[model samples]
Target: MYLGLDLGTSGLKAVLIDDDQQLLGEAMSALTVQRPHSGWSEQNPADWLVAAEEVMAALGVAHDLGAVQGIGLSGQMHGATLLDAAGDVLRPCMLWNDTRSHAEAAAMDADPKWRAISGNIVFPGFTAPKVEWVREHEPEIWSRIDKVLLPKDYLRYWLTGEAVSEMSDAAGTSWLDTGERDWSDALLAASGLSHEAMPRLVEGSHVSGHLRDDLAKRWGLKKGVIIAGGAGDNAAAAVGMGVVTPGQAFLSLGTSGVLFAASGAYQPDAPSAVHTFCHALPDTWHQMGVILACTDALNWYAQLVHSDAVTLTQGLGPLQAPSETLFLPYLGGERTPYNDAAARGAFLGLGHATNSSAGARAVLEGVSYAFADCHDALSSTGTQIGSLVAVGGGSKSAYWLELLATVLDMPIHVPEAGDFGGAFGAARLAQMAVTGGGASLATPPRTERTIAPRTDLQAAFAEGHARYKRSYHALKEAL
Candidate 1:
């Protein structure tokens, strides 16, 4: 048996997979995200460690822990976890959702070398800016920084006494040479930091370290269980969906939404809203579109407009024909296609006659419209995506999936076992590590279902999408 874990923003999930890729046991522990100030999101790194321990205990009771010979880890990307000289956490991890470094991000985005190396425009969510935020704001903590690690790499340090990160996760830090697969010396020098302050980079299939003997004993596992270098959550999800091939893409909607596609070469979109990162698969790359709000927009609308509604699932049944209302899903600043940090959400063309259901449906359409914008941007860059695979919490809603298909005018395939996506991808990597095979073991299992586009709704959606784009452009000047 092997263990695969995803250290997500809201929870820690551990899955036990046998050699045949069959799941034996699964466990998850919920966590809280703290917001001490506006546009700031933080989490305690120690909380993730505790969650891992709790889940491991649960897995120990369910399955024979001694049989678990390997471990793999996937995590929320771009979070900053700083450590002190003796390896103590310096402060709460500033998370990917945190937006406190907009000014620094702007400066970094303007630097020609940053663009030349990382192949990305800067954002507050990326690690380098967050590190600068700490240096400028909390000088005392910044002065004590001995090592800076991504969220998952920090967890691995606690588990295995080794500090390392894989290329896929490292690429999001805005301090990596995506093309050459190494630390960007130019970026490091500009940021007033050294490459020695970062963890060593390793391939996703390489053994990052062995489990610490004491911790391994505590969990009733073998002392030398090897931990495979894992990936960022989205990359792992891409691998889990079989997006390792260049032409395949996946659409995921959890708290945020992502559109990811694999590529053989580093292909970046001009104007640079989409991120080009090294893929978990060796010698490959992937591009992703990140929107800060997706399904969460629907949940927020459901709560505010329809508080009396019993369950969110009840809102999914067939309703009246689509309404004239349009929504802009910029509740938490969009990423892909629109890198506006100050942008706010809006409900256009609303009338007193509009019902709660209309508002709810508008939120769904708004997210789908964002997905459409991503597709358009990729197409403009000469990417030929044949299908978009849908997964994550939002994919379970038929109404949401149908809206995405209509808005994009393309089929959406739902891959099998998507709920365990990150974990499954991690397990697959560990499988390759144990067997020493690369791409031959990276393909995901078959998809479960496909939602074809409705030709009848295409024209209507095209008009809505055009209007949505126009609204965004008009609102940009005022924002």
Candidate 2:
């Protein structure tokens, strides 16, 4: 048996799998994000631990955890979790969606060395700028910092009593030499950090450490069960779906929207705001165009109309022409093509005729348009994405999938319904860690069906997308 633990923004999920690679059992514990002020998002590290322990305990009640041979972890990337010399958390982790460090990010991004070495734009949510934010605003906390770990690595520290990070997670820190797959001294120095503040680096498929004896006994696991150096959430999802090679891609419509394409080599297009980060596997890289809001925008609109997302999406009869209404879906700023942290969402073309359904459809189309922007940005990098497998909570809506396919003019495959997410992918990594297998074990799940682009509406969507693009530039200042 093997175990996979995923620390997500909203919850922690634990999955158990037998040696044959079939899921035996799974459990989850709920979590909540704390936004104490505008433009900031945080989670208490203690909450993550509590949620993790709860899920593990629930799984233990039904499964034979003692037989587990390996463990793997996956989590949201770019969260800055500071630690003191005694290994105590200094504060709530600053999450990936937090944009309070925009000034620090902009100042660091102005230095060409950051892009030249890190192959990224040094966005406000990246770990380096968040650390810099603390330095400027909370110097006392900054001075006592002995190490900075990503969200998953902090969980790993508690599990194994060691601080280690893998490539996929570290690449987002703006302190990694992505091409060389190592920490960049120049970038670290520029961020007011050094190698000592960073954790030991490892490949995601390799064993980083063993579970601590006390925890192993408490959780009914065997002694010295290995822990794999797992991936950031997106990379882990790619691993789970077997999209590990060049030309393979996946579109994620979670709180944020992402278009991820695996690459055989390092290809940086920092100016385009396309993220070039390490893949979970060694000697591989990937490019991503991210939008800060997707389902988040839908949920916001749902609340505004006093209706749930499912009800709003279900009420729509059929896919119609693009609504006169246009939404910017930039509720919490944006990332790809325009790294504007002050950007906000807006609905253009609203009139007396506009109703709740039209607004909901506009929200969906706006997110699709944001993805179209992502597709174009990735295209500018000469990345060839033949098709994209759709994943995440928003993909549950057939209407949204069809609309997204039509907007992108690409086929979107939906895998047979199951838990092919970060936790499952982490389990695959655990299998690799124990068995010494690689991509062969990470096969793509069976495709239940494919959503092909609607050729009839291509021209209309093309025009709508053009207008959507124009609206951003015209109203960015006002919005």
Candidate 3:
């Protein structure tokens, strides 16, 4: 048996897979994010430990933990989890959706060399800017910091007593030279960090350390279980969905929206807000575009209307007509193509006659247009994205997926593995790690169904998107 763990912003998930590449057991424990100020998202690292322990114990009830030979991890990327010499968390993790570091991001982005080396315009969500923000705003904490680690690496330290991170998660720090697949000294210095602040780097399939003897005995497992270097959530999800090949891509509509595609070499359009990062694998890279909000917009609207997404979108008709209302899903500020951390969401053309259904569909359609914008920008990054796989809570909505397909004018593949998210990918990586990178030992995920675009609706969505673009810029200017 092998174990894969994912420490997500929403929860901790543990998956136990058999040697046959089948999921034998799985469990999850929910978590909460703290918002002390607007546009700021934080989570206590202690909560992650508690939740992870819950999930692992739950999984143990269903499977024999003693048989586990290896473990892998996956997590939300770019969170700043500062630590001291004794390996204690110094502050609540500043999450990827947090935009409090906008000024620092702007400072780094002003340098062309920073952009050229990192292959991304520094966004407040990336790890590097958060470090700069903390250094300037909380000098006391900064002075005490002995190491800075991403969220998953913090957990890895807890499980294995190892301070390490892999390439894919490290790339989000804006401290990595994407082409070289290594940390950039100049970028780290610009971000107020040195090489010493970072943990050692490894490929996702490489054995980074062994599980602690105490942890092994407590969990009914043997000591020396190999821990494989893991991946950022998006990359791990892609691995789960089998989006390893160049033409393969996927749209993740979680707390943030991500459009990701793998590449054989580094391909970047940093100046245009496309994210270029190393793939979890040793010899690959990926291009991605992120929008700060996606289904979270729907969730927001649901709360306002005192309804849920399923009820709000339940009987809404046809993809072509969402509503006269146009929503800009910049609730957490924008990313792809704009990188406007100060941008705010809006509802345009709302009429007294408009009902909740129309409003719900409008929120979804507007997000679809945002995704369309990301798709175009990613294509400009020189990757010819083929069919896109749809994952995340938002992808569960059939109505929303249809709108996305029409607006993007591309089919969206729904695979059985979508529900597993990154946890399954970590398990797959663990399997590969134990087997010495043997590709033939892994099983490809099965497709649930495909949602194809209606060419008729594409023209209508194009018209809607033009109006959305205009309203979006006008709103930004007004702000």
Please tell me which predicted candidate would have the highest lDDT against the true structure.
2
Model 2 lDDT at residue 221? 86
TM for every model, in the order presented, reads: 0.96, 0.98, 0.97
Candidate 3 per-residue lDDT, tens place, 68-121, comes to: 989999999999999988888899999999999999999888989888898889
- Clash pairs, candidate 1, are none
How high is the lDDT of residue 237 in model 1?
A: 79
lDDT by residue for model 1 over 1-479, one digit each (tens)? Answer: 87889998879999888887777889999988898987788999999999998999999887889988788889999999999989999999999878889888988888778878998878788999999999999999999998999999999999888779999999999999999989988899888888889899988887888999999889999879989898999988776666788788888888789988888898766375888999886798998878888876877787786563235546657633456888999886778887777777999899988788777778888888898888877777777887688888888887788778888888888777645478777877777776675434545557788887777878888888888899899888776
For residue 113, model 3's alpha carbon misses the true position, in angstroms, by 2.1
lDDT of 2 by residue, 276-330 (tens): 9999988999999999888989998999999999999999877899999999998
The local distance difference test score of model 2 is 0.92
The 10-residue segment with the lowest total lDDT in model 3 = 438-447
lDDT of 3: 0.86
Cα deviation of 262, candidate 2, in Å = 0.6
Q: After superposition, how far is residue 362 of candidate 1 from its true place, in Å?
A: 0.9
Best by TM-score: 2
Better of 1 and 2 by lDDT: 2
Q: What is the C-alpha RMSD of each candidate to the true structure, in Å?
A: 1.8, 1.1, 1.4
CA error at residue 398 for candidate 1, angstroms: 0.7
Name the 10 consecutive residues with the lowest summed lDDT in model 2.
Answer: 436-445
Give the Å error, residue 61, model 3.
1.2
